[model samples]
Target: MRDPWVRGLRYLKGNLFSCPPQEALAHCISEDCRMGAGIAVLFKKQFGGVSDLKAQNKKTGDCAVLRRHNRFVYYLITKKKASQKPTYESLKQSLVAMKTHCWENSVASISIPRIGCGLDRLSWEKVSVIIEEVFRDSNIRITVYSL
Candidate 1:
């Protein structure tokens, strides 16, 4: 279970994907759950009433921070879950997936906030381990941000 990335791969949506770091706003819905009334409303506003048709294929998109930087970069890769309380191992594995994305993009330095804390409702300590473990053996450098 220590290999959070591997475990996540097994469970993260079959069509898992990532986009290069860029500036854009995207809409999302939990494939794991039917769109609630609240989420549907937001989705419609995001895609011009497409929520009623329910045709969005990409959910939980990658969001880059607005802070301007030369080399260093940041991204928010959203994950879908019915509930916020996921096992530590799963959350760790999820971060591993994100770390892979960063590496693929030739990102040498990374700054990710306290993942699984905002809506995921995870503890910072455990989240740190998930992040630290992902980049520890790799060549890329990383710094995690949190409250």
Candidate 2:
């Protein structure tokens, strides 16, 4: 089997929504489903499923999913509330949850921004390693995007 691959754009570039519709999109959000700032604001404006996501009742370190046509949007619950910052541990747990969802659903590719590193203020170096570690054994390909 081919090894899973994770690569990022050389610089902050590209729109996460620009990826092909077949690919899944993921980003970090609080358990409360408040996507009020940063790239999350754009995600909220584009997807608009706050009620559906809150209905899932996911806790921090879980993954909440929203299905759109043939694609899935993954909301990684890295923190308890939007007002609080996220920890690396919670972010890793959320990634593991997301990875499991990808495996179960046969989602081969996913596009994500530097999760937990934007408004959440976690270090990219640490977050990237956590992401790579969580998905290393899977066949899914991860595309890290920026704006």
Candidate 3:
């Protein structure tokens, strides 16, 4: 894949869901999982639904990928356990995997929060750099949202 134009990527200060509808919603999650709070709850309500996500999470392990209600939702594992903090390496690996998945699925546009920077306690500066490194060459539009 050729390098995507830097200008193709965007950063906006607003609710992630408020942006124009995209093909996918991406976010960080832990291996010891629960879509209980924060944005996860909204995702559960909007896309995955409780029982379906719980079952999928159990069957798929850490990186749970599901298509629901005509949208793709990804739960990328950034930490091994709930009590642990998210690791930069794990985040990077997941982002790379996500890039590959997006390419395979022809997902031209995606919206993601500042993954690993909130409750997971990872640094946004580092995570943002990793996102660029992983997706900069992919012909995909990425929107990073802040709320």
Candidate 4:
């Protein structure tokens, strides 16, 4: 039998899946970015100076900041709606912004908490499909934090 998790990836059970503890995430990739698999790496974020977990960045970092949910590494992921859908160029631009930050900090890996879904009201199933397909094959390591 083979281990289901992609190499280097670990599954956190118990609190990890429920009220995951605060951890860091890496650079953000935009809607139309070329994602890498097997070759991916996820770097964690360091504290940027927030008094509380719910605190927002007073200023965007030269690199990306880590997201947290209930004191856990987290973010709500979702897909673009038809009404406010984005163009490839715009998506690419957004991704570029994130990449710039990654480059600035020399980040090689990243962790993500479902991006753009939940309460944001993006369909969970759809989000899963989009991210999987978008990041089908690349050198970038992305760890999807389960909550």
Most accurate candidate by TM-score:
2
Clashing pairs in 1: 4-93, 5-93
Model 4 TM-score on a 0 to 1 scale: 0.40
RMSD of 4: 10.5
lDDT for model 1, please.
Answer: 0.41
Q: What is each predicted model's overall lDDT from 0 to 1?
A: 0.41, 0.86, 0.72, 0.36
Model 4, position 84: C-alpha lDDT score: 38
Indicate whether candidate 3 or candidate 4 has the larger TM-score.
Answer: 3
Ten residues in a row with the worst lDDT in model 4?
A: 32-41
lDDT tens per residue, model 1, 26-68: 2222434343443323333333433322343333433322222
Which regions of candidate 1 fall more than 4 Å away from where they truly are? 1-79, 82-84
Once superposed on the true structure, which residue ranges of model 2 sit more than 4 Å away at CA? Answer: 1-12
Per-residue CA lDDT of model 3 for 3-47, tens digit only, reads 433445677778887766556888876665665666767766677
lDDT of model 1 at residue 32? 40
| lDDT at residue 53 of model 3 (Cα atoms) | 46
**Number of clashing pairs, model 1?**
2
In order of appearance, the predictions have TM-scores of 0.45, 0.91, 0.82, 0.40
Please estimate how well model 4 matches the true structure, expressed as its whole-model Cα lDDT: 0.36
